[model samples]
Target: MAKILVVDDDSATRLLLKRDLKLEGHEVELAKDGEEGLESAIAFKPALIICDWVMPNLDGVEVCRRIKSDADLFATFFILLTSKVDLDDRVQGLDAGADDFLSKPVDPAELLARVRAGLRLYQSQLQLSESNRQLSKTLRDLQKTQAQLIQSEKMSSLGQMVAGIAHEINNPVTFIDGNLSHGAKYLDELINFLHHYQKYYPHPVPEMQELAEEIELEYLMKDFPKLLHSMKRGAERIREIVLSLRNFSRLDEAQMKAVDIHEGIDNTVSILQHRLGGIELMKEYREFPRVECYPAEMNQVFLHILNNAIDAVRQIHEDTGQIAIRTFPRHDGWVEIRISDNGVGIPRGLVSKVFNPFFTTKPVGAGKGLGLTISYQIVVEKHGGKLECVSQLGEGTELAIAIPIRQHRPPHSPSDSTPDR
Candidate 1:
């Protein structure tokens, strides 16, 4: 049975309504006036409240307004008991938030019917509230799933491209690197033999002297070794670049492994070396244990953050920029990477939104705006860590990444991969 509260200044009226409502199968409570009615309504938390228009302290219209205003009590159906039947009086009652009005000299049949109607409306409201809550949860889940799918597709495409490029470049680099030393040795031997012949026979035949003078033989002998050394150095540099590319890709070692985070950071820096022309790159790495992580993905995170720092400095048209990177192990089994830049800092208002997908300060087409968003996911969601940014307007920005030395979970699936960009 529904719990109902009946309020009236007249004891006789209160008793009458109580008797009638009880006979109609509702559990009824009594109140001598509007003040008492409000207190009882709060304490009893009734499904419906019947309040008289005239009362000692608070009136029925005021009581109904209070009930409708309260978040907790707003759902309770309110019926105002009034003697005035004038059109304005009815309108005033409705304006005060009354759900329904019962004409004084209450009709028992009419009152019961109205009570039933109010209860039905309340039930509908409850159902709609529940449905809306469920819909919101479903939408959140769908969005998360969609983001994972997109990330998977991106990583898969990137992995394929990087692996192919690294493979093609590695073979030629290895060949040149192996043959360069032999070529340098051969040149050195030839130069040494020519020097010995010159030393043994100080004077040559007139034709030979003329030939040596014409060809600048002395200069050739002096410069040839240096030329070979330069070529070998160039080949070695190319080989180092190829190695960096392979490290950055790390496709074969996609599974969780003990990885040097410093190596990953260095590889990323090497790949972005061209962009660091006027930037002073500083590294303050303290000795730390190899972290268990997906090296390639972590490298990507470093790339994204470093690229952004470079872009920020460039945006201000700075002739020279500064990017400082520091790494150290936290006592609590976590490793911290702090990357900061002396560039145009993120605005205070936009700092919090930096990691939100598609939110960028750059002009349209300049950026896809997914770089930091994807970085946050890789550091936090995939690794169970934290990624945060601190910035001041017109100053600079610092991004801090902290992850456990060893992940607590198993390797992530393709759907959990970081974004390709």
Candidate 2:
């Protein structure tokens, strides 16, 4: 509906005009005079303006002139209605940016028709403006999706390469551990043989004793087992690292099943524990309800959000900071997961744009700024729930994900809601 602002000095005129516009199903606001009109115009930002031409202290002509002069306000249509009908008066009103003029002793029919005409023009402008806005938003979302697709492909390739590299390293590391284990056994046997020899002979000949001393047999026999144990330990560490890398690159199979939210959080934390080594963690997990979800995708969501909170804490706090994670059931029958960190919080202005993909304050290579954005899509768009955050600069940030205990369809299936479509 069009919002029409009526500006005139006469109280009777303002009331009648406002009442008439309202009866026609338009939202009507009034201003006492040109001065009040100017203030109302900026504040209300009406779609159309119906202004009287003559008034004291800021006349309608001056109001029109100022509105026309301001580039930002020039798009507003101004209709001037006044008693002035001389050629010079008409010229002056037109020059002052009145889109149309209506001479006074107004006919109610003609007034409504002219107002209708202005409303139509205003509506046309609104439709065109809305179309432009939608188009621009669509373009931005398309670009972000394209970038995500490319990144996903790159990650897939990297995962494959990582698995192969881990496999290669695992082979040699396994052999090294096996060889050290076997060598340690052989040394044990050799030591027993020497003991038996000593027991059987009771006494060694002078030359044999000298030869054993020269070889440093005693020292080698004592330290060799410990040295072998150390080597085995080192090999075992390599084996564990190789295993972790393999797990990290495991393919994500799309499967919808009941998943434990707590378990997913545990796995996510375990995977990122190394990254969190420098930060202190405080967890308050309430008993949670399992929900139907794609386990792998859900895991990814946790990873993205948790990683972001960790990064934020690291950035803001020079000293070790705290990360608090909590989970509980909400009254809405949704499970609420909150991940909070005391670190450099988001600026007030940027809080609104955090989920705009690729919008990041991190250094160029530090981040791609898609973590929170992807998480938001997963919780809200994918699972039919909400993702929200409370943050203050220099204080900290809290990211909350509330997903239904049972899956929710958003008037349709979540999988069916494709961004491109």
Candidate 3:
């Protein structure tokens, strides 16, 4: 059924039209004048409008012109009702966007025929609009999928390369670490032998004494051990870096495991060392059990939140910026990690849109804007976690990430294998 509005100053004409349209199974609304008719058309968005040509304050042609001018009302069918029979008058009404005209004495059959044709046209317009909306949605979905695929491939390649580098470095580091202990032992025995030889033959030959002094033998004995110890420390630090790299690239481990949460967070920070040059990092960690999760995927999530926090603070304060990371256990099965920064914060109005796909505050070409979107899927979809942000504009931001100790392991997690930003 179609909704039609009839506007007329005459009470008899209005009632007559309403009564006849009702009998024909069309819903009809009565408007007393042109002004009231325009208001009703806007409020109800009727499919058709019939207005008297001569009404006080606003004429039917003026009403029709306004209706056609509005984009939202373009689908509405308008008809001009008048007793005027002049050819010029008909031309004027048509120019004002009137679809049909009715004589003042109004034939019921002609009115019904015009209403039927107008309703058919309105239905066709609605169907076409719906099709356009669907097409737009499809296009957006395709773009999102293509972008995600590209991101996933890039991360996968990076992970494989990192894993390879870590493997190569690990072999050499292991060789150096394994030899440092024995090397120190040999240096100590040689030193002790020389010391004993000096004690037994306190009076050495003149040539030997000259040689010892030339070589700074006493200082060499003390400093050589210290030098070896320093080398040992350096080797240990290299080993730590290799381990961090291996853990970060966790591509080799496809299955879930109970892993150290603090270590994962540390690995992510270790990889971002270059960008964290001047910022201060403060960590407050509680003694908690290792979490059961997908190590590679969860590492990416930590990277996203922490990286964003670092970026937020680095904007205003170069050397003075601070980022604090805190972790604690909840009474429930969940554990919470909060990354906070004392830098430029997000605006309140835009905070809710942070997780939307392709939404970024950064300028064009600076970022892909997919970091939080991918993070949201990994934490909430794959691991059954909660991620939320609290921020005050111009002050700072804090993002809370909470994940359960264990998960049900969702079946379809397309975005969990990669890093995105």
Candidate 4:
């Protein structure tokens, strides 16, 4: 049985069609005029509408046009009933999206047959809609899967490279760092002993003076401490870099653990030091508890966002770029990390699309536009948090990521509520 609507100004015609369709074991609704019919069609969503050719105010054609234009009613079969059988009239009805036509003084058998045929067409339309919906869902899932696979491969490669580099650099840096203090101390002692010898025996042999001059002893004595101090600083810088690399990779801490959020942010910044030569970074960090999260994955989130910030600021050839990072704990137990960049800001209309997969304003070969999309997934889906963006034209953009301070037992599920936006 199917739902059907009958619209007509004539009382006899309405009664006849209603009795016939109801006797056919179908749910039928009757409307007195075109306006009433259009209302019923929308609210009831009938499978078929049998409308009169002409009526007061709005006509059958106009009602049919409106119904066909509606997305939800696009597949509702329409049948026009009229007394005039002129070819021109038929064309006009068809032009208004009428599916089938019925002549006045309708026969019960013909009405039933047409209704059955229209119902079959409606069912076919529904099936097609369902198929299209399923296909769309499958496409979205496939896109999401592809993005994850690519990220996973990159993560694996990066982890291996970072681990190897840190290890190799740490070994040599440790050697230099360990010997730097002793070397500095030894140089100081030798210089002191040389000064004492010079004081005790002011007059020395011609051979000793000639050797001292050849070695530039006066300048060496003055510069030795400075050179040794510089070497120590360099070794320490290398050690710091290596430490940052290891912390950013977090390969050893694969599982969820309590981690310093500031440490993760600093580690990411340290790794990006080469790119920040001309940019000023400002950090406004608030006191917050160590967040329980997948440290490495969270670092990846920071990496993607910071890289985007770098790319944004790098575009402005005239101005020195600035990226500001602010972190604070919310009263609702979620910590928010906001990264704002004063570069070429995103257009107001496109700010929403920044997180869409494969949607990029970047020129070809520059980027794949999956950075924010993947970041959104990690912060929202993996951590059960909210990723929000606020931007204006030429006014820069700020991406705020909010996640819980403590991860729930399920890790992915949320015990506390995250921000809706």
Candidate 5:
């Protein structure tokens, strides 16, 4: 049984509809004009509304227009009752959002059937709308999951390369360190022996001079220590960078844990050191708390952001551009890391779409735009943090990430969520 509102200017017509609809096991309400029908529809919220085309205050077409405008009220089935059988009148009624039209002197059986049909359509539309909303939500989740999976696979591949590169670099660095130490120690003994000779005889004695000449003391004493010290320092620095790269990759550790964030960043820089030759790199480190995170995933985030910065700088200058990386502690107990570069800044229009996956500004294969996108996921979704970028067209770009030291980290996504296959 449905609630039906009958609106008619004629008392006889309204009375007829009320009596006939009630006989069909429906609850019916009667209104005198279009104005009254509008008010009744708002107050009663009927399942179906039956209204006459012509009325004194407001006409049926106007009533339908007003109801339809209020989508909540329009959800109910609206049927226009009319005495004019002309095509024009029927067109006007339908245009006003009327679901059905019943001509004057209507058969009660036909009216009942039309009402049932409109009711079916209204329910079906509501169901379809709900289904569409669910489908859209599911699609979004799937896209996000797919993006995370691709990002993880890319990081894994990069990690393997980083480990191999670091290992290769370590060999030469170790050899250099050993040789420098040996040379430096030898230089210290020679310097002491020279000082003792100078003390024993204000100038070299005839016999001592002959010994010195035979040993080539002049050449050895001149520049040997200085050269060895310089070489050692350079090699040690390279060794440190290689170690940092290994720490950054963390290929052995897949699960999340507490990590010193600075080490991960240093490794990223070391691995990317070759690319930095064309650009000037600067960093300012601030005090930070140890954060619990997946070191490998976070290193990937660093790689992505730094890679973007490097690319941006490459645009404006052929060489000698600046990329600055700074990290500081925030009052909220979160850490803020910012990478800013004086490169070709992003255009105003392109800023909004940067985080969208597979969107690249580079020509064809030169770039895959997923760097910022994947970085955004790591900082914001995985670690319960935030990532943002500020850029101007010609000046440059600044990418900032803020993450809590301890957070309720989001679990692995469905796409990255694999089972033994």
Candidate 6:
């Protein structure tokens, strides 16, 4: 049952409304004048209020205006009672926030019907408010789940990359270790023979001379230095490869730091070098400032975009694909990097869905389709940057990324908690 309040200057009128409304199974309260009605509306928090339009201190119109002005009381339905039956009087009552009007000598049947209608409206408002609260809670929960999934995917990708790099490093290390051992042994044997020849063969010995000729002593001496130099060069190459892997992974870095954008791009290119067969890479870099960002995450962004470009080129069966990378500083304290490829371009219809999670055009087992989605989040959400794509079917595609040189705050703010999807 709804709670209602009745206000009138006439004692008889107030009594009639209170009695009839109570008989209808409603809890009713009475006020002698408009001022009392306004007070009781707040104190009792009634679902509906009925007041006379003409009264001594505060009138029904004034009371309705005050009630509607208060946010807490605005939902309470108001009905105005008046002796005047003119259209202007009705309009004035409505303009002051009266939801309904009752003529003088109010009919009991009509009063009950209007009260029931007002009750229905109040109930619906309450239901709508509750639904909104529940929806907000569901949105928060979904965001939390999304964050967990993204992090899990990132760790899985890192594990696979680390395994591949480990395998690549092992081959070069094994070659360098085996070759160094054999080279040391050969050098030791040659040193001992030369020492013996100089100490014991001060005079000419026919046997020693025949042995030297058979072994090709002059050629061996000249080629030994070259072999040692080759081994040294091989070891150096292995070092460079390991360094590139380290730079690309950035595993030791857990927070934002100033990092060279060009270095990160070069490192990513080196890591993906094996898959770049027949793909010509051209770079045009300008002097740019180091940006404050999560290096590992940024490197992952580059790898994702580049990998997609390479795959697009391969799919078209291009004999010699071209991937061009360009970087320059913007006038607004931001750096822009653009990676373009001449390959099978993305269809216009699918361009919008490229950043959507788990959306892929590749065949089953060939892709997870999280690459571009994760990249978009890293650039736009985490770094407060912009990532855009331009593509033309049958021509090529280009992706541009822009990030500020310095971050004023931490990477993840409250708003950033929500995933792009």
**Best of the candidates, TM-score:** 4
Which digits, one per residue and each the tens of the lDDT, describe model 1 over residues 373-405? 778888998788999999997788999999999
lDDT of 3 at 91: 97
lDDT per residue as tens, model 3, 1-421: 7889999999999999999999998889999998899899998889999899999999999999999998889778888999999999999999999988888798999988888888887888889888999998998677667656866787789789988998999899889978989999999899989989999999999999999999999999999999989999999988888788888988866566778899899999998877888899999999888887888988988888888877777778976789999999999989999999998998999999888778887657766788887787778877889989898898999889999986655566543443321
Task: Give candidate 3's error at residue 110 in angstroms.
Answer: 6.6
Please count the clashing residue pairs in each candidate, in the order shown. Answer: 0, 1, 0, 0, 0, 0
| lDDT (Cα) of model 5 | 0.83
Superposed by TM-score, candidate 2 places the C-alpha of residue 321 at a distance from the truth, in angstroms, of 4.0
List the lowest-lDDT window of 10 residues for candidate 1: 412-421
- In model 2, the clashing pairs are 316-344
Angstrom error at residue 147, model 1? 3.6
Worst lDDT 10-window in candidate 3: 412-421
Candidate-wise lDDT, in order: 0.86, 0.80, 0.87, 0.89, 0.83, 0.84
Among all windows of 10 consecutive residues in model 5, the one with the lowest summed lDDT is 412-421
Residue 229, candidate 6: C-alpha displacement in angstroms: 2.1
- Candidate 5 per-residue lDDT, tens place, 31-125, comes to 99888899899988888889898888799999999988986786778888887888887888888899988887889889878878977887787
Residue-wise C-alpha lDDT for candidate 6, range 1-421, written one tens digit per residue: 9899998999999999988999999999999998888889889999999989999988999999999998888988898988888999888988998999888889999998888888898888778877998998887556545743875577657845874785688687878867787887878788778869878876657997888789998678778867887877788767666777877776666467888899999989988988998899999999987788888889989998999999888878555789999999999999999999998898899988887767776768878777877888889988999999999887989999999997777476643343321
- In candidate 4, where is summed lDDT lowest over 10 consecutive residues? 412-421
Write down the TM-score for model 3: 0.72
Clashing pairs in 4: none
What local lDDT does model 3 show for residue 46? 90
Q: Report the Cα lDDT for residue 154, model 2.
A: 62
lDDT of 4 by residue, 255-329 (tens): 767789999999999999898877889999999998988789999999999998888787773447799999999
RMSD to native, candidate 6: 12.8
- Write out the backbone clash pairs for model 6: none
